[model samples]
Target: MKKRVEHGLERFIFSSRWLMAPFYVGLIGALVLLLVKFVQELLHIAPNILSLKDSEVILAVLTLVDLSLAGNL
Candidate 1:
């Protein structure tokens, strides 16, 4: 009887994985937001890339690095 109860409890706990589905969905949304921000940064930098001085380029690269270092990094 004790062994049966233990197995039932294990099954019950395993079935609870669905409880985390929404959290995973939220993470997906967060990733989408990050992707959009990176695209916006790219658009903002595209036009000035050629004319940017060394210091300006460094700043832009740092911005990209910062974005990449988010939890996804």
Candidate 2:
């Protein structure tokens, strides 16, 4: 009986791997968005680096880093 119970529990755990598929997909989507945003920010800064305040650049970079961390998680 104990062996049967262990076998059932193991099967349940293994079957649940599919449940994480959606989460991984969502993470990929978020990573793509982050890449787009990073590129946008770079484009925005390239033309008028002097016009953009230092804080603005820092904030944008920080946002990119935050998105990267989220995607990695």
Candidate 3:
């Protein structure tokens, strides 16, 4: 009887780990949103590249680099 109870408890603990699935799914959704924003930013910058000031261009480049670093993390 003690061994059976122990086995059940172990199984319960293992199954409970799956409760984190939703959190992972949410993170993946966030990543997809980030990618979409990144692409949108690129499109926004491409059209006005010639007219942008040097500081504005630097800021845009840094924003892209920051997003890339975030995706890697």
Best lDDT goes to which candidate? 3
- Which lDDT value does model 3 have at 41? 90
Cα displacement (Å) at residue 13, model 3 = 3.2
Q: Per-residue lDDT for 1-73 in model 2, tens only?
A: 9999999999999999999999989878888887887788678767886777899878877876776676577
Ranking by lDDT: 3, 1, 2
Give the TM-scores of the predictions, in the order they appear: 0.87, 0.68, 0.73
Superposition TM-score, candidate 3 onto the true structure:
0.73
Please state the error at residue 11 of candidate 3 in Å: 2.5
- For model 1, residues 12-47, the per-residue Cα lDDT tens digits are 999999999999999888888888888899899999
Give a tens-digit lDDT track for model 3, residues 1-73.
9999999999999999999999989889988988998999999999999999999999999999988888877
Instruction: At residue 18, give the lDDT of candidate 1.
Output: 94
Better of 1 and 3 by TM-score: 1
Q: Which has the higher lDDT value, candidate number 1 or candidate number 2?
A: 1
Off by over 4 Å in 3: 1-6
C-alpha lDDT (0 to 100) for residue 16 of candidate 1: 97
Lowest-scoring 10 consecutive residues by lDDT in candidate 3?
64-73
Model 2 pairs in collision: none
